[model samples]
Structures are given as C-alpha cells and as structure tokens.
Target chain A: MTDPRLTPLAASLPDTVPFVGPETQQRRMGREFTARLGANESVFGPSPRAIEAMQAAARDVWMYGDPEAHELRHAVAAHHGIAPEHIRVGEGIDGLLGLLVRLTVAQGDWVVTSEGGYPTFDYHVTGFGGRIEQVPYESDRVDTKGLIERAGWTGAKLVYIANPDNPMGGLQGARAIHEMIEALPQGALLVLDEAYAEFAPEAERPEIDPTDERVIRLRSFSKAHGLAGARVGYAIGPAPLIAAFDRVRNHFGLGRISQAGAHAALADRDHLAHVVSQVAAARARIAAIAHDNGLAPLPSSTNFVAIDCGGDGAFARRVMTGLGARGVFVRMPGVAPLDRCIRVTAGREADLDTFAAALPEALEEARAAP
Target chain B: MTDPRLTPLAASLPDTVPFVGPETQQRRMGREFTARLGANESVFGPSPRAIEAMQAAARDVWMYGDPEAHELRHAVAAHHGIAPEHIRVGEGIDGLLGLLVRLTVAQGDWVVTSEGGYPTFDYHVTGFGGRIEQVPYESDRVDTKGLIERAGWTGAKLVYIANPDNPMGGLQGARAIHEMIEALPQGALLVLDEAYAEFAPEAERPEIDPTDERVIRLRSFSKAHGLAGARVGYAIGPAPLIAAFDRVRNHFGLGRISQAGAHAALADRDHLAHVVSQVAAARARIAAIAHDNGLAPLPSSTNFVAIDCGGDGAFARRVMTGLGARGVFVRMPGVAPLDRCIRVTAGREADLDTFAAALPEALEEARAAP
Candidate 1:
C-alpha cells in the first residue's frame, strides 16, 4: 500500500523540538532535577488567585472556551490602556508566533532574527519554508541596527527580537527598540517578542504605539506571572493585523481554565509585585552565587541570569551536562559567544542552594574533561 | 509607515470563523446561553476524577506542560492496545486538522470531503490554500464511495470525513469505513475524524490497522470524554506520519491541567461509559421533543440529533433563529438539504427540559415568519 505523501516542505523539515523539556530528561535519567531552572520557566508559582480561578474553572471544562477570548483580551487591553482590538490572545507566545509566521511568511520569503535567538521562532519560519537571515548579537545584546540592515538587504517579511533577550539576558532600552521600529524597512513587520516584558525594568519596556502597523509586541503570562503551563499569551498590534490572526488561528485554542487564570492573575497586582520582588532577590542571590563560584554573571532584566563560564562553548556544554548529571537542571545558549555562558533561572532559596552546590562540582568535572 | 504585509494567500482569504461560538451570541444577546447545545459539547460534564486531577494541576501552572506529552500519549496508546509512537496529541481535533492540512496539502492541492461535513476541517484546508472538492452527502450520511471517487478524480491529497458525523449526527458502519480506506486514491490520506467514536455503536467503530499508512484516525476528549474546554485530542496513524507532526506542531500546545484531566478521564472507564449512557438518554429525549413538535429527528449515532424541520434551508434557519430567541442555543448545517435540519447537542435533563419547553413556540414562530 502507498504511504500518505507529505508535502515536500513537510518532508524536508527535520523532526526536532525547539527545546527538550526537563521532564524528558528526568525520564531519561530516572530522576528528577533538584533545581528545575531549565527552559527559563518561573520557579515561583502563579498567583494564589490565578490558582484558585483555574481550579474553579476546572469543573466547568465541558464547555469550550470563548473563541474570541473576550474577557481576557479586554482585561489585557485595559491594563495596557489600549483598545481591545489591539490584542489577540493565543495558546502561548509560541503558538502566536507560528500563526504570525504563517500569516506573513510564504514559501521562500525572507525573515530576519538575531543569531541564536528564540529557536521556536526560527522553527516556525523554517516549517513554513521561510528563509531566515540571522544577524549576530552585538556585545551579547540583540543588534537592532544589524537586524534593520539585514531586513533591508533581504526585504524580509518578518523581523524577530526579544527584549531582555533570551540566552544572553541582555536588555535593549526602550529608546533602542523605538529607534529600531522606526528604522524598519517598509513592508517588513517587526515581531517584538516581549515574553519577559513584565520582568524588565518599567522604563526599559518599550512604549510602542498599540496602533503601530509595523510591529506586533508579544507578551506572555509565563515568566513573571508564572503561568507558563496555562499557555496564555497575547499580541498587541494594529487592529487590522490583530484581526487578521482570526483568519488563520485556532479560534478556541486557549483553554477556559487558562483564560480565567490569566484574567485573575492580571487583576492580582499584589501577587505580580510580590513575584517581581522575589525574582529580584533571587537574581541578586544568583549573581552572588556566581561570584562566589568565580564566574561572572551578566546583568539580567528578566527572571534568568546568564553566568559567563570563563570558557568556550564546548566547556560551557560540559558544565551544563555535568550539572544535569548532578541533578541540577539548567541550559545554555545554542550558539556562541552566548553559549560561553550557562543560563540559570532565579529560583527560590532552596532551589538556588541546590544550584549553587552543584555548580562547583559540575565546573570541576568540566575542567577535568577532555 | 507601511502596514505589515500578509502573504498573498493569507490576504486572499476572507476573515471568518468556522463556527460562531455561543459566547459570541450570548454577548450580542446580553445574556448567557441557558443551554449551550450549539457546540456539541457534552453538557453531562467530565469525570470527577478528571476534575480533581485538573484542579491539582492548577497549582503547578508555573512550569510549561511536558512538551513531549509522554505520559498522556502512553496511557492513550495502552488504552487502544497500540504503540505510543502511533499517537500525536494536540490542542484539539481542530488544531490537529490544521496541522494535517499543512503537512500534506500544499497550495492549490485538492482535498475531498462531504459538502456539509466539519466546516473547521474545510477552514483548515482553505487556510492552507487547498482547493476543496466537496462531494454531497449520500442520504444523511457521508458518501464514502463518492468521496473516494472525488479523491480519485481530483487527485486530492487529503480526504476528510467525521465518523458518526457532526452537524447532522450520522454514522457509517466500520465495514464501510474500512472499504473506503482500502479504496482511497493512492496518494490521498483519509482523515477519519472519529470525534464521536465513543457515541457510535462498538461495531461501527472501524478497526483499521494501527499502522495503516493511508489513513489517520483523529479522536478527541472533547465529546464523550466531556473535556471540550480542556482541548485535548490525539491522532492515531502510521508512526512516520505521527512523527512528522513534530516538525510543525506547537510542541507545548497542551496545557498541563488539560493533559492531567484527559489522562485521568481516560483511566476512568466507568465515567466514559456513564457519559455515553447519559448522552444516549439525552438523545432520546431530544428526538422525542422533535417528534412532539411534529419534526423528524434523524437517527443519531453521535451526541446530537439533527431534527428535520420539514422545510428548506431558509425555513430551518428561521427555526434555529427562533430557538435562539427563545434562549435555546442550537445550530444547523451550512449547506443545502443538510441545512434543512437543526442540530441539537445532547444536554443534561434540566437543560433538555428548557429545549422541550421552547420547541413548540420556536416552531410556531418559524412558521409565522414571512
């Protein structure tokens, strides 16, 4: 019998995940990680109110979620002081990025992003057969001028950048982002992934016009709000661009419980503030731990810090592997010089204690390895 | 500044939802749906065990859901006596269909389906720029032979059918489905959407080889499992086809609570049997109500009954609108002949009581309308 034929594009695409979850590693190792700091998920729990809301909503799981996600969208809009039309809630920033790529990047279309940026975005672009033009980071930060230049050169349809950037924990000021937006090539849309926006300094959080037609800003409840498992994220952009998502997105993608939790989480300003403060404290602790271990920790505007391992990518990989073998979960950037640093999420006291204990032994093993 | 440019295909598509959610209607009416029977959700509700599992998972929403969904996939595999490699879990059958279309149907590729089959499947195909070759339903059921013929004629890449079909609650026997699978055009993949599989007679549930390369059976927790809001669905197919999903899918699409709920729901066979019984009783009650109102109710193998209004599409539409006005939320097929019937989901006794009370008045108003 003839097998079902996959589209040539689908067939050509490699079967790989953007990032392997810690659970998979746990299963492989037959043990759980002592410090669950990998994947940059907030180890801090979601707001108590969000937890209550999700638990309550669980019993009402018979009905499909509101396809429009009306309440959450409105609440997010009110919080941002933007019209509801400016918002489009989706499964997560990942899901939304996939839809965004599908909407803009046709086969062989050019797209631009920083080298070793969010792998998921690159995965989506590649899955859709879009050619990615990667610009190297300048001093561990997203090279905004380089991205603009690449987009202009390639006539790229989409340009992606994460403020308080992933892997490197580098921050580009709001002024830099606004300048980048203004400098975007005509017809090129900037996909500003602000997944860590809530963790950034308020002043550094770009205050782009909600109605900006050239850029779409994505925010997630995953990092600071601590609801990554709920898969709630939203994009803010021009009404037309936001509405266009409705054409191709899974209308009922968000779960009812997720919507309720995110809505409640948004309303609980106190919990958010508390988590931010806790993260700040944990970040300081992590930096101190790195210093004590004779490593340099990068300044982070997000929940995770990138600690330079004072070695090359291979040495950092060995250290990461050693940490994993020693029951600590952490990750490093996929490409160098970013990969010269190992990324560690700011965890609670006990979690960080485990990380701190594991780091020295892992570093010793890495140095002794061939 | 120039607006973001949508791909030519995306720009060509019209902004439309496959189904207008009851929540949307509720908002416009300034009232909640008294009985949300429109979406074919199991109002009988999910298993208590599932609810408990979800509630417990709610607290752990800080971490992203297991990207591989290993545990849930294994449990589902064991339930069906199939290998875990055969299953690919996704957000919902709607989300899965979109991915399937993307994997197989490139631009302008032909896809065959019954004219008034699942509109969401058609929406996915259209979103991916596939040209649909819709065969008319044979009687009230999907025309399997016609679908095969159409696929052969058009060299369609995909052929879609919902077993124990939606919108018009019809079932094709297992033998027929097996034959249809055998007769599928060489390169065409049969998308057998068995969303209502548990509602169908056991003998009617096709026992296709799990390794069948020509067909992929899509199942859902949304219907009989009563977890529509959880958005968990799986596709069982050839291992290669299943693995290919990894190339383009949102790896962490399923929320943690949703996975827990669905896994628990699957383990509680007693709860599934109980829901099937309840749905059967509700279907009988719904059919009786249609008969009492002098309408013909089609034999239902699914959680809904499509009651023929003994009129054309326009008249049936009026009946549906009248029912809506009376706070009885229901839907109808979107094409001719099939559109002559209104579809009502099986709801709880109390909910069906409201439907029973409002049917006659709705019929009267529909008849009175110009």
Candidate 2:
C-alpha cells in the first residue's frame, strides 16, 4: 500500500525518471557500449589541474564543505568580474534548475520552454505541480519569439531558454537573445541554461549584466571543464534572486571535492581553452561524417549534434535500434519533427570511429527488418 | 508578471533553508573558527585509503559517474550482509530525508516527528506541504509512543523517529524501537534515521530485519566515517520502496569522488571501529567537563553531548556567544526547553582542550551578563 502521507500531487504523479542514463541502458541491454556517444558527456577528459585538486580533496572529505561556498564564489566572481552575491553554485544545472523552479513555480504556475528542451527541467516543473506551456524549436533553435508570445498567452511565472540549445546543437546569438529578454514580462524570471555556452562562439554569448534581477543564468563545470562526474554547477543572477536560493537550497549539497575541483577548474583557463579547441575539431568531424553519409547535420554550438535523417520518427527509431544492436548507444528527441533526427555526443576519435563503423550496418538492418 | 503556470502549492510556500551552515556563521563572525564543533560534524576525519580512492577519481571528473552506482552498492551490501536491492545511497542524510518526504508526505497530509527532532526533516515536510504534528521529546528522547499515538489520531502518512537522536544524543534500545514499529498505524511508513547509529552502543541498535517493508532506515558516512564533508548517505529498506527512488532521483547526483571515497571507507572497518572508540572517549570527556562545571550532561549515544547549562534559553545563548567570541563554535536547539541546553560536537584533543578551557569563563560571563 502507498504511504498515506504523500500529497495528492505526488500521489497522482507517476514515478518516472526523465532521462535514463546510458549506464542503465547498458545494464538493461546486458552489455557495455562500443562507443559512449549518448548523454552528451565529454570523453576527452577534464583539466590536469582540476584532476589534481579533486584528488587532493579526496582525503579531506570528512569535513563539511564551506557552507558559504566562499573561495569558489570568489574565484567565479573574479573570473566573470561579478560580485559573489551574483553567483549561486549547486549540484549541477539540473539541481539548480530544480531550485529555480521551487523558488517561483507553484501549483498551476506556468512554465514555458521549447517542446523538446531539457527533460530534467520538465521533471522538476511537474514534481512541483507547475503547468507547462511548450513552444516548438524553430529550425533547431529555441523559438524565442514564439516563446515570448506563449509566455504572454499563458502568463507564465518563469520561462526557460537554453542557448546553443540541447537535443540539437543550434544557437541564438546575443543580439537576438538580448532583444528577447527585453520582451519578458516583468516578474517572469528567465532561466538561461548555458550548459553549452562555453562551446558557443564568443559573439553568440550575450553580455550579462550581473545586477539585472529579471533572469538567473546557470553554467556548469560538468561539460567544458570535463567535470560532469563532479556534479558542480552555479547560477548567476541579480543579488536578490541568487540570495533567495539561500532561503531554500540544500546548504551543504556541494562536496569539498566538488567545490575544490570547481575552483581549480575555473583557475585553469589554459586547459579549458584546449578542451574547447578539441571539442570544436570533434564537432567539425562529426558534421563532415554526417554530410558524407548524405544526412543533414544541424549547425552545432554544443557538444552534441542533431542529424536530420530526412524521414519520419519511425524511420529514425529503426536507425536508432540498428545502431543500438551494433553496440552504439545514441538517443533521439521525443517530439514530432524533431524526432526525425538522431542525437550523438562529441567523443574521442576512437569513439567516433566506433559510431562510423556501426552506423551503416545498423541503418541497413533497420531498413531491411520487418 | 510571474509565470502563471506554477502549482498553487509551490506558489504558496516561501523559499526557506532548514539549517544555517557553520560557514555562514563563520562569515557572519568575520573569522574562521579554530575549533570547528558546530553542525555535529566529525573533525576526526575519514580513512587514509578512502582519500587515495577519491584522489584517483579526480583524474576522470570529465566523465559522468556510473549511474548504476554498482561498486558502492556492492560494498555496502556486503558490509551490512543485505541484498544490494536493500540499499539506496544519496547525497547525505539531509538529501535522503528530503527525498523520503517527497516519496511519502504530501500537501496537508498528516506526518509525525518529534518536536526536538532534526529540523531538516521538518524542512522537507514543509517543502512538500505536509501537515506536521510534532510530539514533544520525552527527556530529550524522541517520544516514540506519542509519535505512534499521533499517527493513529491524525492518520499520519509517515512517522519519523531518530534513534540516537540529534541535538540531544540520547538513544532507545532496539526492543523499544521494534515495539514502536509494530504499533504503527495502518499504511504509516516509519523512517528511522540512524545517522548516528555507528556511535550507538551495540545493545542500543535495533536488530530489525533489513527486508522489512514497513520501515526504511537511514545511515550516513558523515559522522563515523569522517566523510561529513563528502556528502554520502544511504537508506535501507525493502526492495520495492527502494526501487521507487529510481523513478524520481537525480540519476547522477552522487559525484564520482564521493562514491569512490564512500566505497573505500565502508571497506575499511578497522578505521570505522577506531572512529567509534575515539567518539566514545570524546563523549565521555565532554560529559565529565559538563559535570565539572556544575552542569548536567544528558546521557549520549551519539557523537555530541547536550549539556544543560544552569538557567534559561537566554543564559544558554550568552554562554554560546561567549564561546563563539573565544573562537569555539558550539550550537543550541531552536525551540524552548531544549534551547536551555548547548550542543557540542565531539572533536580532536586540541579542539576539546580549547572548548574546555573556554567554557568556564563563558559560563561565568553568561551568569554575570545581566
């Protein structure tokens, strides 16, 4: 019997995870993947300095992490030239997103996002009983204008827009983003998820005014820093919104190792630049491979690329299955039209080679299978 | 202008944090404490080998941690002589408590906990909009009988009782806890937070079967393992309830370094036993000092001791202040009656010496403050 205490909302909601990890997929499949191209994780690895800092912090895990997150905040502030009050660090963008939802979302409160944006955000909204209004991605980018119009239509309390968006590696430049920001209804907080911002070209990143209270931006060490396994991400926003997080956040959620690793990673700009360069090269290679196969690879500004297979979702599903049977683990979007493509993460040359070797055979089998 | 889509429950709840961290206190004091004793953290520290394992994990922070958490679960299962399905590891006791509440407590759903119990659980209940009915402590031990009675009266969904309770380190024997569990109202789930279990005497720990579906127990690496800073904890329960966590948990919330450190720490029973012995000695020392100062030290099974300082909450506050002024960070309970005592965490010899030296003067000043 279900426990009597669960609220009606929690009780009514089905227990479901947003995205199953590739590890779970592997376990279910009863074998490991030949290439880990799913989940958009960096396989090139983290900075040497970051690794050193994390290793050093391993033994001192007994002491609670500094609750204020002072040193790391100072480092982030110095790096971004913002006061510590403007930055809020959390477990990851996912954890921060949950808190952001908690800060503003209530039963029946409207949350607007692209139909196929991050699923974790969707999970948090429903978990908190928020109503969601979706706008479809226009040509692989978050349809900002459509989003704004819908926000007005739904009178949403919060709106989420990920630049250099996920599922498909497409970006909305700073000018367009800034113009769209001006259109956000007052008191409607914009949650800018910049998990992939590091990969976006310099001109694409909007000039963020730290003192602006209308929006809160989230970034993570998980991607560019190669610290995805470390679970460290921070929200940058106006002092008030950032401070409001203190009122409800898991104060000691960040570990000593995570905090120390993030601080060290932030200081090691040399490694970050190198990883960014490597990722750029990998993206180019991935796009070229798609072109050679007569598939259309969307322009990517992030770690993953969405390749349009020029067919319906069922066809793409067959291709995904074919690839999976060959021990290549890849994913696809859940919505219509977007589901016409398969999404693959940028990995090392060896991983890509595995994907290349597996794709053709899988596609043929998918095409031939009943 | 806020998003109109928020659920009514999320909208009505104010953003609030359950505990003000020691680091925040340090920031407010404008100095770091020489003897960090607040927050009930173990200053004794984690094992040497566990540190090595964490250091090794730092090198691969770029990759996502194993979502299955296989290695860590296997270690815990073997260590406890239970099936792997019986375990669910999380960020810490605090994080797990929040999850448990989410799984059970709902908006206006009745829940029961001791008045002087851990505030984090209450925070979770409030966050989830559960209607809480607090049963006052009976001699600083969670009033188990009262808690059960309240559940029967209010049709509580969950009943939380921490054996080897926090703030006050008193404990009840296993038979008492077992009897309390048997008397629970129909459909009520019992959450036995054993965060301090390792420190409890062998006779005090309940021998309830791990496979029991009626109760879920919590354990952590924070105290006995000296990995409070690492943020690792686990819940033990029947397979079905444990499996349900998979539906809602952040799949990759636990970091790579922490998982590795916890695994290694669990394997090293020698280190754990050593920590237990040291804690016992420290508790005794703290109790003796309380006696010497003409104060009463309540019986303790956990790492900290709650000392009844002569006078009311205000005088206790003064003593806490004087001690803080002298760079010793101790804490007190938030509610009345309980607030009349000061809580001090067990620490290293140097730390205890500092606290012992400072206490007499702090008490004198507190007595004369009016």
Candidate 3:
C-alpha cells in the first residue's frame, strides 16, 4: 500500500534536527559523560527561586497553561520596560524562529544568513521552503554588512543573525547592528537572535527601539538563567508583527512549569548576575586550560570558548571524537575555518577539570593518528 | 516604516485562538472564578509520583530536554505494547495536530472534519493554507460515515475525528470507527484524536492496528493522566509517519520537567484508574444536578457533561454568561443544536457543589433576562 503523501515541501525536506543533543550521543556511547560541557548550557544552573517556583508549579500540572501566557508576557515586557504588546513568548528561540519563518516565507522566497550561523534558523527556513542566501563570515565573526547587502540584493524576506554568535562565540558591536537594521530592504525583517545576549557586554547589545518594525530581537532563559531544558524564549518586535505570531503559533506551547520558572528567573536579578560572573570565571579557566595544552583559544563574549586545535576540520573532528571517547562531550562547527576549533561550554570547575584532564590525551591521540 | 511583509497566507489568516482560555477571561474580569469547570481539566490532579518526578526534574532545568524524548517514548511505547519507533511525542496533541497538518496539508489541500469539531485542528489547517470541508455532527456525535464520505468525495489529505469527542462528550462504538477507517480514501490519513480516550469505556474504543498506515492516533496526558499544564502528547502511527514528525517539530518543545512527569505519570496506572473512576462519579453527580435543575444532561462517556438547558443557542449562551457573572467558569459549544447545552467538566465535590449552587441562579437569571 502507498504511504500517505507528504506536502511537496515536507517531502523534499530531509529528516534532521538542528543539533544532535549530547544526551543522544551519551546513550549511543552506552555511558554518561563525565563533563557535560557541550550545547552551551549553563552548568551553574537556574536561580534557586526559579527551581522553587517550578517545583511548586509541578503540583498544578493538571491544569492547562494559560494559552495567552498573560502573566509571563507582562513580566517579560516589564523586564524590558516595553509594553506586553511588543513581546511574544514561545517554546524557545528555536520555536519562535520557525514561526517567524512561517509568517514571512512563502515557497521559493529568499532568506539571508551568515554561513555557519545558527543552524536552527536555517532548518526553519528550509522547512518552510525558503531559499537561503548565505554570506560567509569574515574574520571569524558574522559579516553584518555582507548580510545586509545580500538581503537587499536578493530582496530577502528575512535576515537572521545571532548576536554574540553561536559555534564561534563572536560579538558584533551595537552600532554595526543598528546600521544593518537601517540597511534592511523595505519588506525584509532582521531577525536579531540574541540567545547569547546576556553574556555579551552591555554596549554590544543593540539599543534598538522595541517598536522598530525592521528588526525583532529574540531572548532566552536557556543561557544566563540556566533553563535550557525548560525551553522558554520570547521575541521583542513591533506590535503588529508581534500580533501576527498569534495567527500561527501553538497557543499553549509553553509548559506551565516553564512559565513559572521563567517568571521567577526573570525576577531574580542577583542570580543572573551571579551566573554571568561564574561564566566569566569559567571562560578564563577554559582558556587557561587550552593554553596549557598548547591550543589557541579564541576570544569569546559568550559562555563557550572555541579552541583552535592546530589543524584542519578532519583533525579537529578527530580531537572531538577522542574527547567524546574520553567522556568529555564537546562539539565543533560543521564548516571550514570554524571547524578547525572545538567548542566547549563554560562549565563549573569540576566539569572543566574533567575536560582539562581529557584534552591532552585526546589531542595526543589525534596527532598520532594524523 | 513599513511593516515586515507577511506571506499572503499568513496575511489573510485571522489572529485567533481556538479556545479563549479561562485565565484570559479572569484577567479581564479582575477576579478568580469560584469553580473552573470550563476546560475539561481533571481537577482531581496528576499522580503524586509524577509531581515528585517533575519537582526533581526542575533541579536539572539547566540542561536541554532530550530532543528525542527517548525514555518518555520508550515508556509510552511500552504502555501501548508498541515499538518505540511507532511513537512520536510532542508538545501536546494540539502541537502534534499542527505538525500533522504541516506534514500533509499544503496550500489549498482539502481537509475534512466535523462542523463543530476541534477548532484547533481547523486553525492549523487554515494556518497552513489548507481548505477545510466540514461535515455537521449527527445527533451531537461526530458523524463517522459522513466524514469518510466527505474525505472520499473531496480527496482530502487529512480527516479529523476526536473519539470520545470534546464539547459534546459523545462516543461511538469501535465497530463503527473500524468501518470508517476502511472507507477512508487512499492517500488520505485518518487523524484519530483520542484525547479523551482513556476516559471512554473499552467497548467504545476502536481496536486498530498500531502500525496501520491509514490512520494515526493521538493520545494525551491532559485528560486521564491530569498533566495538561505540562503539555505532553504522543501519536501512535506507522513508523514512517512517526518519523516525519522529527522533520518539522520543535526538538526541545517538551520541557525536561514535562518529560519526567509524563514518564512517571505513564507508569502510575493506579493514578490513572483512580482519575477515571472519579470522573465517572463526577459525571453522574453533574447529571443529577442537571436533572434537579430541570435541565437535561446528555449521556457522556468522557470527563465533561453537556447539560441541555431546554432552550435555544441564545438561551444557553445567556445561561453561560450568567454562570460567568456568578464567578463559575463554564463554556458552551459555538454552533447550533450543540449550542443549546452548556459543557461542564467533571470536578471534585467542592467544585461541583459550587456548580450545583450556581446553576439554579444562573438559569433563573437567564430566564428572567430579555
């Protein structure tokens, strides 16, 4: 019997996830990793208050979460000193990206992004049948001017750039981003993914007007607030554009426990500051470990450091495989130049110690094999 | 500045939620309801073991939920005596329905369903630019033969029916549903939404093959499992259809806490049995209360009772408004025949007592009004 026919778009799309989570890797390996330093998850953990709120919310899981997410929206808006109409809460930045693409992209529409940028964004665009016009990174950072030019040139519907970019952990200044926003084509949107925003310097965060129609900024609790597993993310955009999300989003997508945790996490300013400082310290230690092993660590603004493994992509892949074999879960970029380095999350001392102990042996093995 | 252009399909869609949640009304009313029996949520609550599991999971919210939902999938599969490959977990049945529509329904693709069926399903179809061909219910029950005929006639890509259906709380025998499945047109998929399946008697449930390519069954922890707020739902289908969900779904949409709770809740068969029994008792009590108030309660196999107020749609709407005014939250169906009744959820003694006391006053007020 013939299988049910998929939509032409769905039929053409490969079954893929943006990232193969570290847990899947561990399960395949038949053991848990000694150091969980991949995926850029904050190992320091969520605020104690957020944990309490989640535990409390657990008892009330029988009730459906407020479809409108009213209280959480209000809290998030207040946190940014913007009206709630300017924000929309979703499962995570990943989910929001999918919605944004759905709202704007039609079949064969053009979308622009830096090559080796956020793969989830690319996944969303491709899933919606949007043609991606990729601009290569320059000097190991997302080339903002090149992206804007490409968007304008192709009349792209959306341009996605993760500020304090992932995989490489690089930051572009606010002024450069503002200029890119100004250069956006009339009908195009600049999807400013600020998943790592909290980790960057304040000045590096663009001071875009919340009501700016050309740009929508995404924020997440996954990094600094340490709730990656909760999957809470919100987008700040123009009121009309924000309202458009209601047309396509799953109204009850946010879990009740997640909403409660994010609400409490937003209220705990001290916890965020503490995590930021802890991440800073961890970055220094990770960089020190890289230097101790004679590897070059790239300067990073976010919670992870990408260490150059002193070889090609194949060599770096071997190093990553060795790390995985040694129970240290780390990742590398999928593309060239970026793939010469291994990315490690900023983790606690114990996690870093495991990584430090594993790295020398793993590198020696890779060198010997090559 | 010009707004970012929405795709033509997204532009034409209305900003609407399938159900205006009780919380949204409460925020507007500026007071909490005395009883929330509108949404069919189990006020009996989830298993204590599930709650404990969620509480523990909250501590590890820093990490991302397993994108594959491995343990949860395995547990769900084991519960149903199916291979794990046949199970695909999602944010909720609502979310899963959205993905199903995305997978099958392209622009202008035809989808068939009951006229007053699950509006969320319609919402997803329209959001994906699919045309809906709605068949009216037969005597307050989803018209199985009529839906299949329509699906066959229109060459619909998808057909939706919620067994132990919502809004009306009606049931159809397994033999009838099996006949409908046989009648489904080739290339058309039968979306069997068993969101309220656990509450239905075994005789009322259809015994379909788990690997049936012609049908996909949706199950939820929202009803009998009492974890609606956690947003866990799964689909049982042929392995190929189940695998397609990975292409479009938010990999981490289900939160870590939710996965843990659902896993624990699945194992707690005792909690589920207790809830089912409690729901049965509450349904009886609600029916008696309806009879005492000189209203007619329809025969129900699910968790809610639809009480006919011996009036037209307008009159029943007035009664619903009166209930709301009296701080008792309840909902009535949106269309005719069905709209002549107000749907009330099965609640605890105290909650039903509140409903019992408020019903007479609400009826009196509605009768007294113009």
lDDT of each: 0.91, 0.84, 0.91
For all candidates, state DockQ relative to the true structure: 0.69, 0.54, 0.73
Candidate 3 chain B least-lDDT 10 residues: B1-10
Q: Stretches of candidate 2 above 4 Å error?
A: A1-5, A29-31, A321-327, B1-16, B210-213
User: On residues A1-370, what C-alpha lDDT tens digit does candidate 1 reach at each position?
Assistant: 2134888899888878798999999999999988898778878898999999999999899999999999999999999998999999999999999999999999999999999999999999999999999999888889999999999999999999998899788789989998998999998998999988888889778788987788999999988899999999999999998888878999888989999999999999999999999999999999999999899999999999999999999999999999999888999999988899999998999999889889999999999997
> Candidate 1 — which pairs collide?
none
Error of 1 at B250 (Å): 0.6
Off by over 4 Å in 1: A1-4, B1-4
Estimated TM-score for each candidate: 0.99, 0.94, 0.99
Best by DockQ: 3
Candidate 3 Cα outliers beyond 4 Å, as residue runs: B1-4
Give a tens-digit lDDT track for model 3, residues A226-297.
999899999999999999998999998887889999999999999999999999999999999999999999
Per-residue lDDT tens digits of candidate 1, residues B253-350?
A: 99899999999999999999999999999999999999988899999999999999999999999989888988889999999989999999999988
Q: Looking at candidate 1, what is the lDDT of residue A358?
A: 92
